[model samples]
Target: MIQRHEKQIERIHKWKEDHATLLKRIRKIYIWVIWLMLPVAIFFWLFLPLSRNTVMIWFWSYYALWQVWIISRSKTVMWTHVARFFAAGIWLVGPLCAGLLWSIHYLLADGAASIQEPWSAIILGPIVEEIFKLLPLLLFLFVTGKERQLSLTDYALFGFALGTGFQFMEEVLRSWVSSRESLLGMFISLIYDNTKEWGFAELFPGYFIHGDVIAAGHHVWTGFAALGIGFAVHFRQKLGKWIWLVPLFLLSWAIFDHGAYNSHVNLLTSDIIIEFLHFFTGYGHWYKWLFVLSLFLAVYLDYRTLNQEKKALPLLPHETLLEPVTESIELIKSILQSPKQWAATMLFLRERRAYGFAMALKEREKPRQKIYHHVQLAYHLLGISALLLLSFLAVNSIAVENPYYLAGLFDGLSAWWESLSAFEQISIILTTTLVTALLMLATGGGIISAGFTAIGTGLLAKDTLANSEQIASILRDPKSFFKQLQEDAKEMPPQELMMKLFGLGLDFASRRIPGGKEGIEWLSNLQSKSQQFGKKAKMDGDRGGGGREGNEGTGNIPKKTVTSNKGKTIDVTPTANHSTTTSVPNPAKGTPNSSVDILDKKTGEIKTRRFYGPDGRAVRDVDYTNHGNAKTHPEWPHEHIFKWNSDGTFNR
Candidate 1:
């Protein structure tokens, strides 16, 4: 009897498990279906006037591209799909609120504002609209006990939906209250619009405002509210607690953004700057922009809170991606020698930067940065590998006719917008281009300045290279950039040191010499006291090629050696003349040891490249023996370790 009962129970459990699995799959399909039908919503809402040919073709093409993108294997593409729909759904609520606004405006205000009642349309409109929007959000906060997973972008969307609804109602009433002539004008326009449904601007007569404008406003107000709420919620969330009072400031910001927007009709302040901001952040009027900006702020807060929460959690060693750690030196040798430890150090530094920025931005803030961190790097590697594999198959070019369609459509729309007479497009493009050029110049200049430093350091190395490795090693150091200057420093003319370090000997210290700042800072810093530690430029006449026999004489020295983000290799470049032309005796000779940890160059180094590996670590060049000072590690990979060289050999 007992065995029979147990068997029955087991059978029931198995049935339930199977049923649950089936339900999950069904839900997934249902979600996909809803996601796929989004283009219909877009068409229905856009309400633009265009030829059927243009409308249908554009819509179909757009729909297909969106479909392919969402279903793509890339998580970046998939998440974007979800976000767009979320934005759309957010806008749909506008129609309903707009209906309410129409009822209020006509039933209460009767018709256009009288000469003495300008404030009625301005003040009343915002009051009613704001109530509609904020009430729902406040209600959610009150009932949910805590809104933990909510982001600033979500708030922006919510605000947008509220504004949209208000706009719809307001427009309906505006149309209803219109004169017969205007009504006739609208009807005739509708006929024309239906014939040429190109974009989403044809439904103005029957609606409050365009969906784009409406969505933008809603997004702004909500975004603003989110900023305040975000700040309030940040610390509470980090502590794993909740407080209803957190969103009060957010609510106030919404009020201000909306109230101010409604109050202003000024052309310069209201129409231009306000309108510009509204459009920039996806709002109808500039008044709404503060709200969207707020949303961006909220996103920032949300990420900060989440990061803090993550940090507060107790760490365990289970080999995970979300969290990782390197081994410690509790019972082991030195920390620097341990490969596992260095790996962890590099990983932490890389992750902090990537995820740090990831959570800081809202849903649509330039995804490429995050993509680079989480996936694009891998994709690039895969792309290269695939190229190599395809070459073996003798394929010259490959094109996947999937995601490019949407990109092309976007290109067209952007082009059309660019061609428009509106000042909005012109200002945006001009400002963007100027900013981009400036950034490019800054970055390019930074690189060139750095290059000059390396060359100067190499010059300094001319005298410093007791052996060839000093010259060769400089090329491999993180300071390889500065090493360029130091590379031949030891061999440079005495005058070159003044030229490189101070731009002049003791006479010229602070005269803002063109590229002298970099060379001076790097080499001069190398000197602890007042001693100048730079190289005087060595002319061809000052060449020092004392090919002294290396301690471990130059025998079969590998052509080139490449090191990556901490000796790890991402790629290996050819050694062909890349190494220093100089060589010297190894430690086997009397060459004094003068190596320092200056080459531990990579900071927040995420990925590493690989170069050619030669026979087991040989005395590739001279022996470096400078026991320089090391900085204390606050964000170290793990607990530190020590591995003293009992002999000259230790695990590198």
Candidate 2:
């Protein structure tokens, strides 16, 4: 075994040495990608919104090259790192972060509307984006077994790469969507489409919403803040537990800087900066200068930290090779080729540590990519609802001008509105909104993207109400909370737990609109009906010979019963609709000698028939049509002849 292991290790080394030429080619390709992308990016930036296709081409090309460059610079960059970073950024965090920030805008719209500058940029934007951005890094740490391994420099590099990817995608989205039309509005259009017949031209497309500015140095600042947190984490022992406070301060600074940049106003020393700049030159844009200054400072800090770390650890000769994995070297090869299969195996084995490690080995994300998935859902629902309102209004407007449209179900939209009860109106609004959104999703081309945006926007309201501050505090000591949840889950059956959750969801929805109590009550009633049906089904299974193996005579079938909400009960009896000789249900199997009287009341004639066998398949002759002397034991041609078969087959 030892000799075999040595041979495997030697073979691996030989393979690596042989692949040096290929590795060099790969490195050159990365370089080419970067150089090629720069020109296209610059061109797009110079000629803003020239076309959607051009902008997309530029952004993707730039992002791909930028990511490649970042990876190329690192000595220890691996295929795994490249795949994981891109997957986390492009697939997971990017869209979610955008959605989070968008939702915040709508949530705080009323308060923000009062402010001239973008309010979300200052408050909610920082919290949402920063936290969401941090999540990917944390996930990386957890998956890569780097929670303990990561140095401050590593943190800074990872943060920078991740933030760049996230920001680039965000820029692409902004370019694709119109500044004037919120994702919310786009979603609402679904409901409107039902009532109004607007041309395809009126619909907001990628072309109309262009010229989206991709902010420079924005992500660098955020990345720096993350790096500071990583530094704090690294030096927690020396900092005496108070190290955590450093991250908070750094994050706050990052947020303020972001807000200042986005709001286009200096948040810290606006008056002084403006005056100083104005004194030098009559033109004053203090925010732009401040943004530039902040970027410079963040970059400087990041560089200094990385330089110090590099000096301490030092890079390998090539400065870009993976550490030699031992023990399961063959397994590592398999994983590098097919990381997903390795992940599945780990999961199957219930090896948490191995699974996490394996997860970081490829381009895969956690199932819960966005913490604000529910928020997105809420936004989609809301957007659909708003559209429904607008569509109804448009329909009403048309009806007023030309009564032939509605034909009098409504005199106008107002008359129709006035006729509905509060509950009815709310029901119509929600149901119609949901239906419209689904229909739009099914039919529309760009609707999915719009829905994602709206859903992201919807998260704002939830985030505000939930309060990140409170959540942070709770998260610091989440043991008790998690324990409580675990206990609840253990105590409740899955079905009951699901019901409770559904009830809670309905409760949340009800709180949003007037007469929402009706919705909750309606849901409760539905649950009760469902439960009753379940009970009946269970009872049927219990009472009857439930399985094919249990063959009791067919005398145990339960009668159907219906009960109303008011306690009125109705019994239903089964009747034979087919032309077969059907037997009446009894408690037990029929005895061979037992006789039943077949009597015709109109003719006052009676004929007796003796049943034989468990199923009563064999019977003596009984013909009500004959006045007298009906054959007792009839042949095949007789009026009524039956024969029993042991195999449960019948013959007459």
Candidate 3:
């Protein structure tokens, strides 16, 4: 029965794995489809009136969002929350609050003029709009029950989305009424026009517009409040019972800023605040700078919190034996060299963050099924909405164009159609439809393949680039390079160092070396002679059998046994004064014996160590002698990595 139960559990686990694999495949296909459709949608949107304004807004908003995404260590924000909150801001919060405020104004005051009444715009409007803008996010937190799991950036992003959506709706309405040639043009004018003595300029300061009307306008206010909420939740332990006050204070401040702007009232005494800000910043926008400063502080706090959290989590498999500082430096170098590498590196970091989050969630006994479900639903909704929007725009563009032009084109086509028989017309229509569908499929497949190829090439290029410098150095001076390699071999495993050296030699030989192929032949012959000499010396000493003194003269090494992480014991032998060789017993049958070598050097009181792998192949190498004041004091270690090829050569 126990065996049966174990078998059943195994089957269940296998099924889950299969399900996960299928879901991953589906998600990839969905992402590819989205990418393919995005260009088409943008093309359609461009044909619509005021589309440039919408595009510009999206560009700036996403740019800011990207910055937030970068600053965040752990990406905890769900796409579902982003889409839902933004949509709610557009369809629910914006319209509902605006309509409610209008009703209140109509009841209290007279006509269109009452819309700008002090009670409405100055006090009530700010209070209503600010609270309503946050309602969707509050509801999201309550419904999802992810209040504790969320990062500060997640909250800020949600707030930014909500505010951006609300502002989008407001701007659309204003643009429709104002008879503006382009909203983008008007925005540019507001920024550049210093001569226009507009009352709205006082609210934003520096910019000749109202704060809430500009791009990232309402985003700044709402994001500030959301950040406070994030801080309060994250630091609940430190704040004790007063945690609620943090968000409340920030929310009140947002409302006050809105109200003050609307009323044209200066809360600060005289121009003291303005003058102080001007003296320091050379700009009189104290409010703007304060908000900016708060965002920076929030990012710093989030980074610190993430670092603290990471300390408790187990290291990733790749990170276990590798030095993180060294790995990061290599990653940065690769990123700088290639744009593809930059993208791949970012994706890798994102995956690592996801893994970290998964581990953290597991430790907390939290189920992520709901989050996954939400993400899928959001993606589907977004995909459907985008398709519908694009379809509508395509139709609308044609419909809104000059009827005569379209009619003339249609008449010509109609005449051509009339010239053909019914059978020919049917055949042509079918062929055109089939061809168009095939072209689209071909284009999409090509795009998806290209993306994958680019990613793979980027990773491959990074490895190639790793050895390029060393190969270049070897080409310049093989003798000096070989001498350095000999010194490194003393500290590193013999097999690993030899594989690296062999690989570098092959690369050097392939390049335009000083002595060409003859030089390589000479080097190979020299290595063979050295090996023969060592073997002869060993045989002579063994034949004499003169005990320890004879063994020492013959270079007989002293061996010590040490246990590996796998709980297997391996013999470590010092073959030379500077080098020690560690023999690793192969776990699998029919495999060659694997060994590692470590070289240690002592100078006066300071010691330097280099570690290598059991197979004499190193994924990374670190040198500690160069870091800090190594001559006077022991320095922090640095690493060098090499990729081992199946053909007994180092790839890097």
lDDT tens string, model 2, 1-652?
3345546755764565577678556644533443344444444445544233334432343343243233222112222343345345545776676555445445765432322223333344444565566667765544443434443444555665565555544443332332234466566544432121112342111111101211223345445655665655544444554555555555544444443333322222233442342334312223224433533443333322232322112121221111111112322322332322232222221121222122222222223323234224433443443343223212100101111111111113354456556854444344333222322221111212112111211121112123224334445777875676557555432222343344334334433465445544554454455435434433211211211101211222234343432354544211111011112323134443333333222111233333344443345443323222235522211244565567755466
Pick out the ten consecutive residues of candidate 3 with the lowest summed lDDT. 396-405
lDDT, each prediction:
0.31, 0.36, 0.44
Query: Which runs in model 2 stand beyond 4 Å of their true positions?
Result: 1-75, 101-117, 177-216, 265-652
Q: Best by TM-score, which number?
A: 3
What is candidate 3's lDDT per residue for 1-652, written digit by digit as tens?
Answer: 3345546755764464457667557645644554455455445345543344444443444444445444443445434345446556667888778777767766876634455444555456666777778878766664555655666667777787677667645544442333322476466545632231113223221122333222125666777778776666566556563665667766665665554443332222223432342235323244455666766566545433433334332222222111223234434443434433443344444433343343333344324454344434433543453343223222101111101010111213334556656754444344333222222222212212111112322222223234457766766898997799767644433223443454445444445445544554554454455435434433221221111111122222234344432355544322222222122212222111222222221111112223334443434433323333436534333334566667666553
Q: Model 3: how large is the Cα RMSD against the reference?
A: 21.5
TM-score of each: 0.29, 0.30, 0.43
Clash statistics: count for each candidate: 88, 4, 13
For model 1, the local distance difference test gives 0.31
Span of ten consecutive residues with least summed lDDT in model 2: 396-405
Candidate 2: lDDT of 614? 42
**How do all the candidates rank in terms of lDDT, highest first?**
3, 2, 1
Better of 1 and 3 by TM-score: 3
How much is the lDDT of residue 582 in candidate 1?
Answer: 22
| Per-residue C-alpha lDDT of model 1 across residues 1-652, encoded as one tens digit per residue | 3345546755764464457667556644533443344344334325522212223432332332233222211111112222333223224344444455555555775432221132332333343444445555544434442233344444444434333333332322222222222465466545522121223433211111332333223334443444344344434433432332345434433443443333232122333444554445445344344543444444344333333332221121211112111112110111222222223333322323233233333222333333223223332433443343223222111121111011111212434454545543433343333222221111111211111122222222222222334333544674764766655443332233433444212112222245544544443333322111111211111212211112222222122233321343222221211122122313232222111111212111112221212322222222121122135322211111222255755332
